[model samples]
Target: MPDGTELIVTRSPPVNSNGVITLTNRHLPQLKWQESLLIARPVNQFRDFFPEVNNQNLTEIAIEIKETYNDYLKSARSLEDLKNRHPELREPYIEVTSAKSQRTIYLTRLDRFGTLESVFFSQDKQFPVDLQLVNNKIDREIPNSLLAVATLDLEGKSVEQPIGAIALSSVEEYNLKAGINM
Candidate 1:
C-alpha cells in the first residue's frame, strides 16, 4: 500500500503544432513502470552508452531515493511482508580524471578541449607502484566499489587503465529510464 505522500510523476512536455512546448498531467505508463519498477538490477553491466558526469551533485536525487526507500520501509506492515515488492534502485556515481598525460602531444590535445579537468594526481610527482597494487586489491577483493578494466600495450610507455566509467551511469540511467531525460 502506498503511503500518504503522493508520488508525483512529472509528465513530459508535448510539442504543439505551433512549435510551443506544453506540459500535461496525463500519465505515461512507460515513465511509471520505469520509475516504479526498473532499478532493481546492477548498473555496471551496461556502461558503454552512459555519460560520465562526475560534477553533477546528486544530493537531490539521493535525498529523494532515501526518502522513498525510507517510506517503503516504514510502510512495511511487518517483517514477513513481501520482499520483492518495491523497486531496487542503484546509485553509482563515477568521477574520472586522467592520472597522467602520455606525452606533450596528449597534454596539448587535452588543452584544446577548453575544459580543464581536475587532475587526479599531484604535480610533478610520481606515484609508487603500491597505488596500482592497492587498486588491484580493491578490484579483486572489493569488486563492488570499482569496475576497472586495465590493459598493457605492447609498448611499455603506455598502459591503459580505465576506471569508474560505469559509476555515474548507475544513477543517470535511472533518470532516463524514468523518463526524466536528464
Candidate 2:
C-alpha cells in the first residue's frame, strides 16, 4: 500500500489488455494495480547506499578538505597557481571574485557541461559531490538530502568508500534486466 500497509494477495487475478491487474482482495477492494503503487522485490539483497553523514569522522574530513584548499588558496596568486601547486585538484573548476567586496569563491564543477545543477553522486564517477568554498564557509551538494559517503586521500583526492553492492530501484532493475540502458 502507498501508506506502508501490506496486504497479501489471496488469489491470482487476470490482467487485461492494458496490463492492469484487478485486485479481488477484500483489503483493497476494486483497487487496480497501478504502476505507481507497485513495489517489486529487489533482484538481490538490498544494500542501503545512503548513510548518515553526521558522523564525526566524515565531519572532520570535510573540515580538513576545506582547510587544505583554503591554505593553498591563501598563498596562490591565482587559480592557475593553486592548480599548479596542488596537482590533485582536478579540472572544470569555477572561480569567481566580487569586485565590490573582494570576496572570492571557488567551486569544483561536478555536472555535465552547461548543466545548472550537480549530478547525483551515484551517477557521477568523478567527484562524489560538488564542493564549494566561499571565504571560511564550505558547502557540499546533497541531492534530495542524501549524502554519498566518501573520504579524502593523502594527496587530497576524493576517495569514495566501498559500498558493497549498488542497489537499483525497481524500475531501474527491470530496465537493466531487459537490456535497457537507462
Off by over 4 Å in 1: 1-120, 123-138, 145-156, 162-165, 168-182
lDDT tens digits by residue: candidate 2, 1-75: 789999999996765544333333333665567567433345234336534566899778867976887677566
State candidate 1's TM-score.
0.16
lDDT, candidates in the order shown? 0.33, 0.37
Worst 10 residues of 1 by lDDT: 103-112
Off by over 4 Å in 2: 1-80, 84-88, 112-182
Model 1: per-residue lDDT, tens digit, 66-161? 788767766664422422321121222222333452211001112122223524322345432211211223233332322333333435665544
- TM-score for each prediction? 0.16, 0.19
